[model samples]
Target: MQKLSQTQFDFIIIGAGSAGATLAARLTENNQFSVCLIEAGGKDTSPFIHIPFGLAFLSRMTNLGWEYDTEPQSQLNDRSLFWPRGKVLGGSSSLNAMCYIRGVPEDYDRWNDMGAKGWDWQTVLPYFKKSEKQQHGESEMHGADGYLSVSDLRHTNPLSSTFVDAAEQIGLSKVTDFNGPDREGLGFYQVTQENGQRCSTAKGYLTPALTRSNLTLLTKALVEKIQIIDGVATGVKLQLDGQSIELTANKEVLLSAGAINSPQILMLSGVGPKEHLAENGIKVKVDLPGVGQNLQDHLDIIVQHHCKNRDSYSISLALIPRYIKNTFNYLFNRQGIFTSNVAEAGGFDKTQYAADIPDIQYHFLPAILLDHGRTTAFGYGFGVHVCGLYPKSRGEIRLRSNKPNTPAVIDPHYLEHLDDQKVMIDGVRRARKILAAASFDKYESWEVGPGPDAQTDEEILAFIRKNSETIYHPIGTCKMGDISDVMTVVDSQLKVKDIKGLRVVDASVMPSLVGGNTNAPTIMIAERCADLIKQEHK
Candidate 1:
């Protein structure tokens, strides 16, 4: 470990999350340049993080997770939704459901259309392939040998297969591989796992690179602000163990602090809207209006059902014996229910109003997820998560107070747009239809949520308003765009506008949210970003 006393490096990357982990590992590969990776959270030594099924318990771990709550949303009956982001080494990748989904090609092409040049699907697919070590071997679309392990689930509940079968029975085609050419269909989801264990970026990238002398990793170091001189980022001010310290970046200061903190850091460092900065008692340095704007997330609502069959995995007194057996099974052989990623199966489909691509995504869980898996329901049941992939609503991340310890105010402005409400309603109605298919006739008992009483559009909308929660994919707060884009915080190369030696290389730099999960796309972004940085600095 490099001591804090050594306060300078060729590169300083903040937030040891998905992007930072990848960038740090990739940038230091040559050993010609020294890199520093700092994380606000402690080391990812939690045993639960490495277990696939441990997601059930990881959400309640306040220390390992950034358990942030959104500002009360007016559209959702004035409810504050909880969003759990990973505060560990791999960031959300360590805490996420482990679903390895990349959005459709058109999703990235849309970014090209939105002024993010060189980021079209054709151009970005290489980066996606570059970081993947697919279990099924290499294809034109997948890499066989790479850092991250992408594979089929080691064990999947029969209920998960039933969900796919139910979708097929409802006239939906069954897709064997979602990351292949076609993305719209029902199928089992591949996960970021290796031999039934989670393969977080920390496992794929950081752990291997730790042996290299050029890389320095500092954990539990909270970066309070960026030090900008003459509109150029030179270093950062971070607090560690109640002591403040400063570290200089000889070449560049890369902000890979995910979506929320990346924007918060930018704003705190005087690189946000001038007016908001003044109100927060921050000195304006760049006056960029797009620092925390263009916030987007997938708000999902689940349709739960009561299962008549107890064979399926669910919470019940009868399952205790099975649970004990499964625990032993996992400890002995690393197989069984312990290998399940909860949301073992899912699919994507376009709604009637979708524009050229699928607009709704599904995550079929063998067990019900209540309160983001915080509350345990006492019964054997299942849930189908329905989310509008292309949400029309936009929100922002703003400073509640100038203090770095204060959590930023996140207002997703969910369902604020009328189209978002309709899409979510349609998605739920579609999910209901799939669950009602004849494939589940034997298991069907009764609808546990929104029931038959919530049939009409109004009733369904009301149900959604009351029960919707974030699917944990948030992006586009420090959006990348063309030079002409007035709201762009970073250019196409991810360079902060009007600032030298600074870049934002994370989900926040995405011009728009992808069609599915954000983790895979974030890794791809960092893969390409590492190349960009090396090419520029070499």
Candidate 2:
């Protein structure tokens, strides 16, 4: 451990999240390269983190959550949105809804067209398949021997089934597998879990690699800045247990600190827009303007309905016995309400205004979720979340200060574009139709939010402006593209532009936002990145 500061390793991966965990594990598999994985947070041993249903309580666990908030959105009545990121070993993978969607083929093809060469559907599909251990068995579309677990939820509430049935009743066909032949239908989302527990990257990759002799895993290590000399990144300056240490990378320094931290680390190290760095008292190392630009995220609108049945989950004195039973059922049988990842069922769909693909996504929860689940309203209820997949609006992540602990300035600028608002309005209307179907008539009493009275487009628009929130998917701050693109921070190979021995390999490097969850794709990126690094040194 003492050699971390005195000797250089083959690679140093920052942020131990999805990409960092996968990249570190894959890089050390051959026992040829020594890898060091650094994480700002401690271990992923929190009892709430491993339980699938504990996500309900994770939003409030500040120790494990990097609870960030966006600047007041001008289009959303100047309301700041809550953004929860996992700060533990597995990163957001431990804090997410655990949906295992790889997005549609066109999503990657769009990346190819956007100047991220060799990242088209066909080229990237293999990586997705390579990293998955699907419970449904192996096929051309899925892998069975991979490390990450992909399985169907052990149990689902009846309301989730109703949501699917209602979607089918409205001409939206039912799909058994969203990651299969088509992603344009309704179904339950397969989660990243094994048995009844979560299979976060920390559990999937880092745990196994911990026993490897060549791998070094550091926890509670805050990386202050990259130690860049001339044009090459030599190492990183990080603080661990009140001690300042510098870890050198013999081969390369991989920055996988996610969308916000990745760009912030870059800028703090003097590798961002020259003027912005100068304004923040950071000397310019490389004037890369796209270091923290082009941020993309999904702004969700939730429609809630009061429940007519008492059996459904709710906060009530009468449910004390039920809660106790469910707890024992989960502890002993490993199956029950506690095993449910609140977002039990969800799917992707296309509106009439879609651009040749599914442009809308729905996450159906059997329980009410308000204020990012921060404010709980008593009584039985359910919610359906609707989010426009691809937003035209872009934002930025800037250094709030030079301090490593200082949070980055996140401005997602949601709904700033007129088209984003229009699509959301359409999404809300379609969500209402799904709820109105006969399938939900048995349990649904009435719409509690934006109620039945708010029917006009102006009314819907106004409702959206006041209530839209983030769905926790953020990407593309340090975008990857060809050299010709001025806004590209990293090249097609993920190398930091004009900088040697440095690379950005995380969601931040995504040229555009994928049509689905970012965790699976982020793991795939690290898998491929491991190959790239290995080939370069081979």
Candidate 3:
């Protein structure tokens, strides 16, 4: 295979993940400019990857995942749970369940408040629209023709209608679109899928752009460090197949390497906390304290119940043929339960006494998820994953050493804030209320988790302490805000403040966590960042 020796690409995108793929696609849409995308993972060619229901299988497979384990979380009784990220073309987006959540409208409005200028709902909404092919069609809140397709859950389970009814019974308002003008209520989830298949950024953005003559896609090229010269990014040193190679950036280098790797790459290239680097024997090029700080993740605990009579959607010995039929249906027609995004349906909501925005997000899965991210679990049970959207807990990501191959120290100090634990406890209580509603009475036999007898808040809290896990949404490793935000790596335009010709465009740039799933917003950042890069050159 030939290697890139020229330092003349119009743009060089690091990490062909959600944001990087979109950036490469959008920027290279024209034939005039050359765009190069380098990914450490090989091609995304798994059949399970395209099937939404296959999320269960793929979540456990290591080929499509950069499976990471957190350092023991002392707050959670010292458990180092798994954290899987996509290493393939669309990155995590390809491996993820493909939930299409834009978070709260106020989230963007608050971004404007937090010194992220022009990122308010009105300003950012167009970018969201530009990247969407909504199932609900174009409206005041959605678009019809975009790079990504947003569709309703075609494989709806009986548990969905029951969950919605139970949520309403517990006083949560029912809604249709969680990403609409008003974002406070329970509703059917819209996913990033097309014809029942997962619509990853590789399919949505990169596929079309790859046809462009100026675009280049390189797989298995691991970026070791950004090559900085006099406080400006000039190129990068990449290690490919045990061989070191250097490639220059003619115009600019965009680090869409995601929250974890972007900051890791920056620190390895000598551009982070001075003392931290010196301690590791790496000379500091830039003393940016915020290079890998302000990490946030949505923590959730499942509440399970054993159904009585024919209530729970558990299959039977008689249902084996149906399951087999659905499997073949997905293999051939790309439709059926095999395409089920187990989080079949859910919504955003908050109690009356809760904060202004919807603080709690829900994930209602039809299957009993005994352990999270597991391809298979026992029993015909269901899970209600309630998470605090904007948590008070703040964590950080730091380098273990200067080695790019060395996984960074990812510590998401979960439940560090006493308030965060309290909020999560309250979130668990709310989920229990919905589960215990009259709508759920039909399914009630025995409480599968925490058991029906443990009703006190303390028991609920204890259950959360024992079983709560990350919902796999991590952000804020390179938060973007204002100059006063001395700890921040990127400014409002997402440019590395102290480094020229460099930008970080991934979940890491989120100043604060959004109210829902991060995939849609991450791609939106790429769509917007593409214009920002072009404007800089023009």
Clash statistics: count for each candidate: 0, 0, 1
- In candidate 1, stretches whose alpha carbon ends up further than 4 angstroms from where it belongs are none
**lDDT (Cα, 0-100) at 272 in candidate 1:** 92
Candidates ranked by lDDT, best first?
1, 2, 3
* Candidate 1 displacement at residue 268 in angstroms: 0.7
Clashes of 3: 1
Best by lDDT: 1
- The lDDT of each candidate is 0.91, 0.89, 0.83
Model 1, C-alpha of 246: deviation from truth (Å):
0.5
Best by TM-score: 1
Native-vs-model 2 lDDT?
0.89
Pitting candidate 1 against candidate 2, the one with the higher TM-score is 1
Who is ahead in lDDT, 1 or 2?
Answer: 1
Q: Which residue runs of candidate 3 sit more than 4 Å off their true CA positions?
A: 2-7, 308-318
TM-score (all chains, Cα) for each model: 0.98, 0.98, 0.96
